[model samples]
Target: MPATRTLATREAADLIELTRSLAVNELSPKAAEAEADETFPREVFRMLGRAGLLGLPYPEEYGGGGQPYEVYLQVLEEVAAVWSSVAVGISVHALSCFGLAAYGTAEQKEKWLPGMLGGELLGAYCLSEPHAGSDPAAMRTRAVRDGDHYVLNGAKAWTTHGGYADFYTVMARTSDDRSHGISCFLVQADTPGLAADPPERKMGLTGSATATMHLDDVRVPVGHRLGEEGQGLRVALAGLDSGRLGIAAVATGLAQGAFDLALRYAQEREAFGKPIIEHQGLAFVLADMGAAIESARATTLSAARLKDQGLPFTREASIAKLVATDNAMRVTTDAVQVLGGYGYTRDFPVERYMREAKVMQIFEGTNQIQRMVISRALSRPAKGTITVLSEN
Candidate 1:
């Protein structure tokens, strides 16, 4: 809870404090019970919306906070430290809005942007399908052109905020051209033919609903289309670049939470007539955990800074997500180990932390996919590579 790093602006500092207050007072207390019950805390999201936390990274003219990605991500980390489900929900909502914000027509923005950013309407991203989780380009969800609408048919898998979202930002195939066939649509949650399947029984993030959304003859107006017919893939990929950073921050926060718990327990729990932290064996573990958490935080923030500067951050984003999430998995697991048998029990939250941390490496693209992204980026030539003439 102590200051981990200094803020660039007073406003950023204020936002962090506000988020911390909410996380400590509201989120942390209810996380255990809600996760235990597998209940989605819908009202808590509304409270966050009302507090102007939901739209931190969007333009201020559209009722958002208009903060830099760097500031917004840190706020996300603060919330994530207490309740990861809520933080992940926040990240998905931001991603759901990205297409419209970045690609929608001015008229569309005028009509829907304010309400979306104002927090009255929670949003979900629907790009992944059952047959195509990693290779979204191979998706088969179809959207046929109707008189004045596009009738969507197919299912989206692993949809967060599935049944509860007020709106869904969906991507569906519109043509046979594999590279340029998809399009984005903003569909209202109450659309007659759209329904969420039963939630997936998950190992972690139980409080966050994940379900397959069925689009059975769902009709969205042509006006709801976000960009050109073939631009959906581009929009989705660009959004993921930022979304990866969000997950990175959340992963870092999760690691920090686990580390804090382990440290506190070490200080209080004694072994061999002294605090276990006094023993070099256990002390080294705690030290390594601390080091990992800080490293993850720095990697994530560095990516955010690049994003804030409008630099190309695709590689950095993947790197951040990979490092932070992998570190989170390790740190949370170590926290459980540090607690010895007590950590494995439900009586302690380290078990839950370990469970939650596992999914961070899997979602927002798997760590395997992240490595692919990083390596592919590496394969590309640099923008400026100086060459010196050499005689062999």
Candidate 2:
């Protein structure tokens, strides 16, 4: 079933329709094969880029679609419904651009934003290290200043699009001050000494590659530095505020997809001389799933609206991430139950959906981390307080 969204503009509605069409025609048909083959759908991304779907939340001057975050997130949701790996790739690409788009100077934006947002160049974010997944301040990666460049040495773990990305937005320590010592850099993939480890074999989203990126004295020009030195942590956190919302939107979409599948299965599969949907117990489960999906979607969109309004939405974003992902985990699991034995096998997509939903709780800051963020925010006086929780 298509989501009945109350969009703010006609253009937004049209965009969603276009995204649905694209997902149906381009993403859905190939999703299973790509995942089965563990193939990264690079051409699909390029196709989305050509269709102006890659840079929806960025400014138009830099070859972006210039759509608001609300519209962009909905497009992401629509895409996620059909192909989660592609949706995750789009979200990560947006995150990779966040530091540069939000903090880069005019010259930096003019020089790099065009290609980066143009969809011709894919990007990866490098912040999480083997030991520093949640505590970014504890990261050991270092970027020492040279005459005209910075020599970076450290490994970033769990990098999406790791081996295939055209550029990387990296956060590395530039000084001894844990919180204030980090700096952000835009590093080209072909830079000497930079390499990607073999992709991790994952239980789900196999079509999207995940690998550790090794930066062994990789030299990046000073001009590629984003924002001021010692301000990388701030830039990274700012990006994550938006990234959490992206994940929230994706989670809601995943739940919605699961709910739709379960509802359809219940309606068509007869049991006890009637459709299972007519059974009171199964009917109640479907009702709960529908309510959960609606609630998750509402929470996610509310956060996006707060962000679009330029309000302090860190707490709301965390809540959205926590609620939406947890709901997805539950909803997808129940969707498999709705399908009975078929859901457990690869013959149906619900099994894949269930597997894909698991990681949503783990990434973009774990659900526990989200709770910590919410708790910290609640502890503070409510006078425009924004909790600064570190996320990778």
Candidate 3:
């Protein structure tokens, strides 16, 4: 038997089935339109929220699916296979919810958890700044302690759902102790002095809003602090680890979706004497794409399994994120090749998939960061090395 089945639980299977129906019936149809218009599908997100797809992997007590991370990520992969923007947005929202789930007080959970999990309120994570993309220690966003609140000041860059989210989990400097000086806050979007700096024109994932968030002396109550005063870096890093897993899932889905399109097109599109599927050259490319997609899926699922088992998944997650995203870029580009001239034009959906794949490699701490994480995970020792004095 498999160490752990990918789709074991009936609840998980049902949730996957539901998401598939939604993806095929709703997401796939509007994907092209959304990408072309560069419009955020706020309503589509609400539809997913209503379907309870947004809450997969969360506890049922909070109006969530209560599914395992493995299953949830697979479902995420399915969503991404059709439209990556939606899949990534869902993952980012889940990352925003992490602070409360892992570190918030019970009262805080009772108050904020339901809306976030229910998808009634979207979420945005604010850790990267103009100066700090992968380096949190260089963050300039400051949160000064006041009587009962912290005054937040600075801009958060490349924030997904920037203006659209109901909440933002912000990380800002509290002291001059580098990374340790950072603090995390659950700042509502309705808070005064918080403004989104217009959506950016990006290479892909245009359906998901991306912008800079300006915090002008915004006051976040002391009660809204995620963990301890100076524990923000820990929280931010944890969120990033989990976010990398999410990206891995999305990347796998994109690859699979692109492969499926290429396969069908190859089988149907006739050339020369017969269908292109009969051609050895094109067949080899399709086979490689298939292998890459399946491998990415397996790797991503393994990382999720490690996370679910409460094991150290840092290395596994980084590996998954790195491999899956790179595969997505390759698979999508090859898919465009499969379509020949049609792929190059907006007339075909392969062009959109190709554009979306580029961001997957760049976001969620970048593939370079993933390599660093994997290296550290591999290089670290369980305990400090000690030298025994040899007989001299």
lDDT of 2 by residue, 32-138 (tens): 99998999999999999988888999999999988888889899899988889999999999999999999999999999999998988899999999999988899
Tell me the lDDT of model 2 at 109. 98
Model 2: colliding residue pairs: none
Q: Could you give candidate 1's per-residue lDDT for residues 1-392 as a string of tens digits?
A: 34386898999898899999999999989999999999999999999999999999999998899999989999989988889999999999999999999999999988898999998899999999988998989999999999999999999999999999999999999998887999999999999999999999999999999999999999999999999998889999999999999999999888888888899999999988999999999999999999998899899888898788777899999999999999999999999999999999999889999999999999999999999999999898888433343567
Candidate 2, superposed: residue stretches over 4 Å from native: 383-392
Over the stretch 139-212, how does candidate 3's per-residue lDDT look in tens digits?
Answer: 99999989999999999999999999999999999999985889899999999999999899998887889999
Instruction: Please give the clash total of every predicted structure, in order.
Output: 0, 0, 0
Q: Estimate the Cα RMSD of every predicted model relative to the unseen true structure.
A: 4.2, 4.1, 5.7
Model 1 segments more than 4 A misplaced: 1-3, 383-392
**Pairs with steric clashes in candidate 3:** none
**Ranked candidates, highest TM-score first:** 2, 1, 3
